[model samples]
Target: NEVFDNLAMFAGYGFNKSHSAAYGMVTYQTAYLKAHHPVHMMAALMTNDADRTERVVRLINETKGMGIEVRPPDVNASSLDFTVAEGAIRFGLGAVKGVGHSAIEGILQARKDGPFLNLYDFCERVDLQKVNKRVVETLVKCGAFDSLADGPLPAGDLEALGHWRGRVDAAVATAFSLGQKKQADRDAGQGSLFDVADGLEAGPVSYPEASPWSDQVLLDAEKQCLGFYVSGHPLDRYEEELGVYATHTTETLERAAEREAVKIGGVVAELKERRSKRNDSRNAFLTFEDRAGQCEVLVFGARYAEFEDLLKKGEPLLVQGSVRIEGDEEPRERKIICDKVQLLLDAREELVNKVTVQLEADSLDEATVCELRDIFKKHQGDCATYLRLRVTLAGQAHFKLPVEYSVRPTDDLLQAVERLFGRGSVSLG
Candidate 1:
């Protein structure tokens, strides 16, 4: 308590020149090491955060991004903390959610005599009580046991792969019984002490596939290691369509808002509702994005009334309006708000951000609207804007104003428009 009181000391003052110089030197050294040897740097990061599971996962991704191949945590090779060997980083057993240091240490100690040849060999050597099926399964899912397993099980065979997990415990129990029998043999002096080496069971089974999964699928599996999706984002599937309506990627959107009007698109990541200071009914926030990136949408009750339909998460919308730099009155510079969403389509977002449908000047007939419906249906993001084109058929001048009006701004709508109209006709604005 006395030491704690002295250490508190109401925080501190600025650093001296020597302190600054030393700090600068360390910072420069770290930066240089990171720039030149990112894998090693990330391995060190993983080790430092051994007790912090979440950060350890992040560092693992960072290592992979640097092209450092991570050796899965193996019964034969891993330690409690992440280690680097021969320019490769090993997964840290301590990074797994349930397996703590003591449990990991127990497994590592078992490996000291020799490497685990297979699931059976590991079962014979390691203590199951310290490390259970749940712990082992987590390692397998994260690809930590991949080296020992040889290769991953077949695609979609993940659940069936549970068989190998049970093998470890069964093999260990069998090895214990053999050791007891050997003890009896030794006491009788009837057996040769130095004999032929024993063999291990086959590695975890491999499955048939023409090729490994696509990068997108592999990256998704990697996300199970890290809490958040790291490699390619979910929006990567429809980059062309998302870019049509989205003003900018979330990361880029944070930087500027010069344009008076902009269209930004994103998958609806999340939505939340809140009450204003005055307890007014309408206050909400939304986070979504396209492959380029993502952005947030904020709406107050008054604003929400008009844009309520667009506020939903995962909705592909080309929102047009002003970008106001909020909190600019004070010292802090903040985001520009996207005000008034004109069109939020229910369907997939396409390359065309907006749709312009042409109608004959004189025809309000059902046939004309029916034709418009058929044409608009082809669009992705289901977005459409109707425009009447008046031209002479030589007999009658036909004109039609929209009696009922709507469009689904979807990704297909954009692509369909590109096919029907010229590429430039369906612009985001």
Candidate 2:
């Protein structure tokens, strides 16, 4: 009660100056350390928050971007906590969720003189009671035993590890039962009734074929140990395609506040609809997250309707617009005022909202090209209007624009041509 009373009083009338001073010193220390030595900082950070999910993830992201490689937790190589070696951050086995630190330490210390080369070697040397099946399973899931066994596929290691853990469990149970029977049999001078199952001997146990898991599976495993993904970013898969339309990364956009006609990319996290208090009009408020951080954007009037369906959550987008600085308007609010919201990959092509099909200029039969034109003339599909033809292959031989044609280059048609005609023969121009 006394402690609570003191805390309440301090909370109500805290000394901001003194607190700020203390906080400033700590902040400076952190900044200085981070700028000078990042790997040690990351390893220590991982140790402190070995159970947290997001913090560790953020740290991992920050660390990797600094060129420090975070190797996955391994049975033979890893220490109990994260370690900094040669400017790289090694994943801590003990940091993995569900695996006990004591068990991890036991395994590490057992292999201190050397690494366990195979499954049988691991079982033979390791203390089964301390570093049991559960610990081994965590290692396997995190690709800890990649150095030892050759599983069927890259992913077969996990399956093999799971199977082996089950066997280890069964083996322990049988061994306990057998030991009890042996004691009784020795006293009675006869065999006991129990026939204990020792399960499969470690040497004969075959490793399952392990195929590599999809991106999501690998991420989940990373999440288990270091509190976040240490191997790859979730956005890495779409980054290349997304880059085509996105003119600026998060960092560049933040610095682009004063520039005109900025382009930014992100995954849409939220969207809100609103009506103006002054008049009957529609607008959208958007929140998006890129690799760096979150930004809020606003789309006013007709543009909102143009991009309504695209504002859905988890939809990745590239937005081209002006940065709305705070106080730029009366009683101003800070935001990005969007001129356009679109798929970065889809929007940045030379032409947009239109599909173009290009035929091999040299290979195309002149009759076929004319036939394509005649067919389009018969069916007037005004909805899809963009078309292009490239014909000059010889040096300085200029392109000859064909007759004005309107053709609906649907996705199906593009895919069909790409599949049938092969790579160079067709392109979504």
Candidate 3:
């Protein structure tokens, strides 16, 4: 019995040592690949986890952090798997929502002759039966057809249709009509105008006038179709404001102290309302996303009732809460227990009391002064304005504008000021 026990102990130690050695070798290999071939390694990782949206989002962010760009899916460039293109990663079509393997195969086969010329050409060439209108719409929304926008339009074909995406969307029906006719003609073994010996061809594709979608609308469409933002985030325009007001971001929250009071700003990515069985009190869980990533914010009982109206999805919000940490595991579960919530725009207006613009002495000419006055007049409000002039290399002067020159510190007003003077010229207090 003693000998058997001794043998068992030795066997356990030997197994543990061998396991550690194997794990250490794998770690070394992974680190070497990450350092030497970051782009390829990241592309492989993203492609491996393409079906998992959350994992893909995290990996894409990490890829960006490594100074590698991950371009959106392009019908002209992307393949079934993520590929390295010009030292960057091109998103895969297979990962795109609403696009099946068959659709990808059809697109790949159709584009084998050459690149797709335009939306009309793409619709006419591909098998519309397999790559249906919904798939095309999803691709358009996710920016796969953005490259085709650079193609030249026919002469004298001018319209007020907003952006290239807007024009393409408006012309989808007409393009589909033409594509269907061509397909029917081919199936019937009938020659179309293009097949004629003469240089006869179809008329130019025309797009109707339509207003462009807002940035938020475009971003929402991307999120709906690709499960993440490709071109830009909805909160991108509010970056400066968030930097000034937010005390904690999703990335920073990982290291935050338990029960630490914190203020965070983000767009509400998702929301779920629930009722307690014991008292039937209402509560809610919100998936809040900032520039870095996403986190959960919990609003319970009284807090939920106090801010129920403001807890809307896709709206930017400023949340004040305490970090609640549970478990002593390697990755502890963390969530924010909401104490207060308000619209980010409203918070900016209420918190900022002063706006200061810095200018060089030489640039503050009569015309510049007039433009500044016009900007102030356009956004009249209660926030006080001050001008700081750099008179010389080591000398400066500060002047407080009269109450009449004061203006609201809204985004438009700030943007106008920055545009006139330059970025980093306007600071809000």
TM-score of 3: 0.82
Task: Name the candidate that leads on TM-score.
Answer: 3
Clashes per candidate (backbone, < 3 Å): 43, 10, 0
Best by lDDT: 3
Residue 315, candidate 2: how far off, in angstroms? Answer: 9.8
The order by descending lDDT is: 3, 2, 1
Candidate 2: the clashing residue pairs are 96-225, 152-209, 153-209, 153-210, 154-210, 155-210, 155-211, 156-209, 156-210, 156-211
159: Cα error in model 2, Å: 17
Candidate 1: tens digits of C-alpha lDDT, residues 1-429: 988776565334334656889999999999999999877788888878877755665566557667787765555667777788888987667765667666687678778867776554554456665666665555544545545644465533322233433333234444445544554565688556342234333334333222334333444444455333433454543454555545665556656654445556554545678877786677767655444434566666777777776665333455544455666554333233556664334323334434454434555577655655675644323333655364666543323324334355544554455444334344342
Q: Which stretches of candidate 2 lie over 4 Å from their true place?
A: 1-32, 123-135, 149-206, 210-212, 224-227, 247-429
Ranking by TM-score: 3, 1, 2
On the 0 to 100 scale, the lDDT of residue 416 in model 1 is: 52
Question: Against the true structure, what is every candidate's RMSD?
Answer: 13.6, 11.8, 5.3
TM-score of each: 0.50, 0.48, 0.82
User: Tens-digit lDDT track for model 3 on 1-429?
Assistant: 999999999998888999999999999999999999999999999899988887888999889988899988999999999999899999999889889999999999999968887788888889998888888888888888877765643321111112566767777788888888878887899966655532134344556655665556677888887778876675665677778888999999998989999999888878899999999999999988888989999999999998988886467789999999978896787799999998887888888888899999988889999999999999999999999999999999999999998888877887688778876789877
